[model samples]
Target chain A: MPIIINLDVMMAKRKMSLNELSEKVGITLSNLSILKTGKAKAIRFSTLESICEVLDCQPGDLLEFHNKE
Target chain B: MKTQTILNIMFFLAWFVFIALLIKAGTILTTFSISWFNDMAAEKMYFDLDLSMYKSYSPIHYSLIVINKVILITAQAYVALLMTELLKGFNLKNPFNHLTVRLMEKICFSILVIWVMSIIHNAHLKALEKSVGLSAEYLDGSYLLWSALVYVLAQVFKRGVEIQTENQYTI
Candidate 1:
């Protein structure tokens, strides 16, 4: 629950809309929404690779850990 | 709206329609029986009763009636359960693979049960000097066969999910 998907922040930094990212990454807009909303339980490496390649970022830039306390 | 929520709404609507149809059928059957019974009673009063034919046909008629009701209720319950599982996806982890497998298992079990019940039902109808429509017989077999196919597909999906999860560990 403490894991964070920083897709929204990365998209903002890259000046990209969700539709643009979805088209670039070859993932559906709905799936990207799931990742952006932190609703996905897990992400495939292939999907991560696509996102990283398209956004010019490392996987670490898209994922983060936070302590509940 | 989420797919699950939409499915839940649709399921509830389907139940409402099923209940209405049941009530309508019950009313029609009751009226028919009452009229037929009165006519039979009048004939019995006026003449010496030869009750053998009536006694034989009555049980068969009753059995057919019972079978029809069972089939309707069983099918409705199956659809309702399937829709509920579909609707739960929005909140589930690994919704597509996880929920689909669960749904497929339920569907398989339901189809098997329905198929057996339907065979008994068709037999009852035949006993009553009635024939089931070709479509009805086809539906009975198709539902079960399709369920089996889906169950196999769900296993493949489950394996894919497991492989994906394992590969994540190596990375």
Candidate 2:
């Protein structure tokens, strides 16, 4: 719950839509949506690598840890 | 030979056992009900155990013995029904889920209750043995071990559900 997904921010910086990134990364729209909405529990390294390569962003840019308390 | 075929076979088998248990429970119930009005009805078939001696001993004890058998058999039948339900909702692709885990827990608790009830049934019969010339043969106490095994499996299934959920969320 403390982890935040910055997928949307990176996608916006890259000026890419969810469908475009999904097609490029070979991931499904629903999965990308989960990552975009921060609903994903964990991302596989292979998937993260694909997303990074597609969006031209580091994994750190897509994920962040924020303390709630 | 496929897993789905095996599961389908098990599902049908569970239903078969459930119906068989239901019929047995119903027969014993009918026998007990009839015995209430007619003493001769006590000497009947399908009870697995001949408990008619208690009928001459006392009406209350007779009723207790027959009723206990009914409850235990019905409970066993209920477990079979749950097993059928569990297999009914099971999906091979998504075997780990909340519903499956919940059903496993329910089965575990039901078996535990049966085990506890069996122990009590045996103890009560043991106390009455000398007075009624009861046989040493009693309900098997192995259900305790069975319930324990089911409880452990349910815990493992709960963990499987968590892992599957995490895997589904993984992108």
Candidate 3:
């Protein structure tokens, strides 16, 4: 998909470990890992909201779109 | 008993019965007994469809009968096996997996094979009617419709598996 998850980059910039983000976002580590690894098909608005609130970042920082060749 | 156990027993019994019939067919081909068919016809059961119409039987005619019976029994066995596989899938934690969809596809393929075999058998019966005065006319349409329905069901199951994967991956 053109839409890519950049969750790992945001987490790195914020110096947030996966376990810490999972605890703060109230989601399982596996689910958070799925998103961070760009394996997630979609992000729920509530989950995105929780992640943004925890990391203090915009949705754009966690998601990116690059045109596929 | 749970439904899965019941289904398992039923499928096992069905396979056993079909295998028995296959053995009986083999014996019939080897013995070539008219009285066996006559006894079945006398019972007026499923075998009485067009048995009365055959006044005499040649070796070739008996061979045709044997072949047609084998085809029908093979189709039934195929269906029974597919049903067992489907029941096994239903017994799983995730019944709507890719393997389930593949089993459904195999079912559809088996139905199609049965339909084609039925058509060929019907044509052979017509030929026998012209050559040997055997008045059997078996033209079943349900198998074609059934195959189409199963094909659609396989597609639905395929979509279900895809959605399940998407759901798992969604965060």
Candidate 4:
């Protein structure tokens, strides 16, 4: 849980909606929402690659690390 | 035949047998039957509980016999019903769900109850040897190990359900 997903920020910077990103990344809206909400247990390299390509951003730009304390 | 069909057939048969046993236990059928100590084998291999001793039909004696049969039959019926539920899990889309795991644990618990009842019934028979004129000599407690195995299997199923949930949530 310390690894937070900042997919919403990247999507906003790219000026793309969840539906648009999902359509371009070839993933379902629900799955994209899961990634955006930090509910996904894991992200496949292929899926990450597709999302990065669609959003024009690196994996690090979409993910962040934080300490609970 | 499909596995679900087979399981359903088995469940119905078990339920039917349980109902038959229940009827038999609820009635006075055993009182009139001739129970003998042996089948007249050369070595006198077996003994049966003779209920014909109460020719006058003492209410207390008749009730005792009925209660004993009812207890044993009820335990058997409960075990059969548990097995039916266990079989039902296999027909589900996801057999390793929480409900299935709970059902498996209930089956293990029911088997333990049957095992404990058998031991208690044996003990009662031993205690009543002087009055009843018959007793069971040996106690076959093999089901305890089986119950332990079933309990372990239920735990494994619980773990499986956890893994399945995690996999589903992994997206």
Would you list the C-alpha lDDT of every candidate in the order shown?
0.64, 0.86, 0.75, 0.70
- The residue ranges of model 3 lying beyond 4 angstroms of the native Cα positions read B1-57, B91-93, B137-139
Candidate 4 structure quality by residue, lDDT tens digits, B1-171: 487788789888877877876665544333333222222221221125344433223435534544555676676777777676667556456778877788778878877886887677566556656676643344466878988999999999999998887776664
Candidate 4, DockQ score (0 to 1): 0.53
Better of 3 and 4 by TM-score: 3
TM-score of candidate 4 versus the correct structure, residues matched by position: 0.74
- How far in Å is the alpha carbon of B87 misplaced in model 1? 2.3
lDDT of 4 by residue, A1-69 (tens): 899989989988989999988889898998888888888888888988998898888989988899999
- How badly does each model clash, as a count of residue pairs? 1, 0, 0, 0
Ranking by DockQ: 2, 3, 4, 1
Q: What is the TM-score of chain B alone in each candidate?
A: 0.55, 0.93, 0.73, 0.68
Interface Cα RMSD of candidate 2: 0.5
lDDT of 4 at B26: 49
Candidate 1, residues B1-171, lDDT tens digits: the string is: 576667668767756665655564454345435535554532232124222243344645543544464465556565555755555553434544666667767767776676766666666545444442222221244656766786787788678667755543332
lDDT of 1 by residue, A2-61 (tens): 989899999999999999998999988877887888777788899899999999999999
**iRMS values for every prediction:** 6.5, 0.5, 0.6, 1.5
Report RMSD for candidate 2: 1.9
Kindly list the per-residue Cα lDDT of model 2 for residues B1-171, writing each as its tens digit: 499999999999999999999999898888788877887778773745565677877888778777787888899999999999999999988888888889888898899888888887888788789766766458988987888898898889899998988888988
Q: In candidate 3, what fraction of native interface contacts survive?
A: 0.95
Candidate order by decreasing TM-score: 2, 3, 4, 1
